[model samples]
Target: MKKEIKKIVSYSSFLALILMSVLACSSSEDSSSEEADSDDGEEAVTELHAAFAAFNSDAVTAILSDDGTEVYIETTGYPDHTSVYWETDNALYIDEPDVSKTTQDTYIGGGQGEAASFTVDATPDLTGATVATQLNTIGIAVSGASIFNDQEGAGDLDQAAGSLDWAGAHKGPGVYHYHLEPTPITSDDDSLVGILLDGVFIYGRQCNYTGGTPTDLDASGGHTSVTQYTDGVEEYHYHIINEVYAAGNYAYQPAYVLFAGPFQGY
Candidate 1:
């Protein structure tokens, strides 16, 4: 009897050990599955809402090239512009404007002024014109209908004109952002120019800048600083700095680019 009882106790102990091992393995599998599902859910959300993001990732990819350089026109006070080159590393190479040069005649007194006068005459019956035409006339009026002498026949400016449709499509009501001059995205074959919807501008993997800090100009012109982080670097958006500061000497700091997608940090 004693021998039979001992045999039975030993067998029971072995079966208990096997049961514990099975439970442990099952718990680990459940935890791992939950983690994977969480990751997948986050990716789905990013894919769904990417279009509403302030910067268009696809557009940036299309325009910026490897080892390319870009120039940003600063219209803060004196309309000073700066050029930055992206080699192996991002670097700023400032280009100062020559004040001695007079405005070119070809760009000045073109059909733009006459067109503005015609718009004013036609504004009496605004109800008759289409919304697009009325909006174009309003843009001309806000810009003072002045002919830009230095801007005539420039391919850069022409590209900006082409991008107006894209800008208008993405623009929000009361959000006023404009690029009077061409923003040259220098590529080897052909250069591209486009206006940014937000105050911020991102030039590929190399560098990014803002004309002024983010502001809500729709209601009232107020300032908000946007900080972006990407690839282990943070950058601030540049915008029209204070007019009191010298044009070329405006303050700028490195900020980050907020990228949303599968490669969030990249």
Candidate 2:
């Protein structure tokens, strides 16, 4: 069932085109875009971005909106990988003794069962000014977990680094989320991490375009170039900056901040 859904989503361009056509005939100017609530100068997409295929098929389902101007990503928010946060009875659980569990009783799926849905513009408004990311899930990782900013509570992430597992993620009172580079998904090399709330894909430290650390990144660790998924055409995307975060007694020392953003794609 999961494989079938993934196949449909990964190759639903034809279906998306039909939907777009229908929308075009009925309402031409009412597609959502960069201005979340506005439809002016909106661009309709023909399909879901190919990068979405990198997400965990078992836990995530990405679909094009009826108007074809937005992508809806729904996830179980349960990672397919082994983690200290998983309940010991669950198959993916692992004992990371070095990691400090958030609470002896707190575990993934212990609360409301970490499920979330997000709707983002198919085409990000790059021409608009940058927008800052707020607290909570800023994006979803390919591992089917939430991607958070370098923050824990109202304070900096330094205070909670010890709680993070090998994946640089931990379960707070809410969902299990990553605060630093999720090495299980991407390390020093260039790999598709996930898509951000601003509708831009974020990659690992090294870029496939240059085969090394990008030299021309904006303040948000984003640049325009050909990623492994872009075929030959250059596209705008974000990368995990190569700089080490050097925070508290983190299990992984010299960790890279996943994303600290004033989103350029919004």
Candidate 3:
């Protein structure tokens, strides 16, 4: 999907910059300024990453920031795939006899629905310390739904695993989200899953560069490598961790954790 661009023009009164003479300038000044910028700068980007094209166009739209230093992602929150979470009257609704939904009365687009919007840095601040993901929406999935962490409420997700649908998702009394590897978006392959809060793209269990599971991932399941969309350039990204998360009768037994993180790209 093509992002709607937000253009910005600075009309500062101090418009002209004075150039220093070559003999008057010190080499240390340039080196010091460059180091400072690298440590804290929010780098500007010209365009959205190519992998965003894989998102469901009908339910999601990305808007580039006016200064080209951020991307605002908006989603209707309703997934394109069929799920028991949808209302019976909805065309995408489907019945899963074996699955236990969070609530029979609760459905997608009920009160708040799944609609959401958030801004992320155009370039991830990898130089800073890693930031841990919070309880709410950590990222937006390719299916146009939210991506949640491995925990539920104040505890782990094992107790609620039975309610997950065939694709490993459920409406947890709020918006619909995925807690495990969403099969509709990615199975065990090297598919693009979604972009996270820190502006890093995440993939499936396999790494596109190695054509297999990546062994050098940090605690956040991230590593610098050439993704399918990076045009052969090595860029840092996350993957759905390969370890199986066992829960009670989950349709996809030994489900993979989508991302349980102290995000490296923050």
Top candidate (lDDT):
2
Q: How far off is residue 226 in model 1, in Å? A: 9.0
Worst 10 residues of 2 by lDDT: 28-37
Instruction: Estimate, for each residue in 1-266, the C-alpha lDDT of model 3 and write its tens digit.
Output: 12222221122212322223442355567877888987656789889889889999998899888778999999998888999989999998999988888889889999566887889998888988999888879999989999998888888888888898877889977889998999988889999999999999999999999999999999999999999898999999999999988666786577888888989886
**Which regions of candidate 1 deviate over 4 angstroms?**
43-158, 162-266
Q: Report clashes for each candidate as comma-separated counts.
A: 15, 0, 0
| Model 2 superposed RMSD (Cα) | 16.1
Which whole-number lDDT from 0 to 100 does residue 156 have in model 2?
89
Residue pairs in clash, model 2: none
lDDT of 2 by residue, 1-266 (tens): 99999999867977899888988865644433335555464688888888988899999999998788899998999998899899999999999988988898889999757887798889887998999988899999998899999888989898898999999999977999998999899889999999899999999999998899999999999999998887888999999999989876997677888998989887
Winning candidate number (TM-score)? 3
Candidate 1 per-residue lDDT over residues 53-164, each given as its tens digit: 3322322222211222221111111111122211112232232232111122211122122222121110011122222111221221111221121121233222323222
TM-score of candidate 2 to 2 decimals: 0.84
Better of 1 and 2 by TM-score: 2
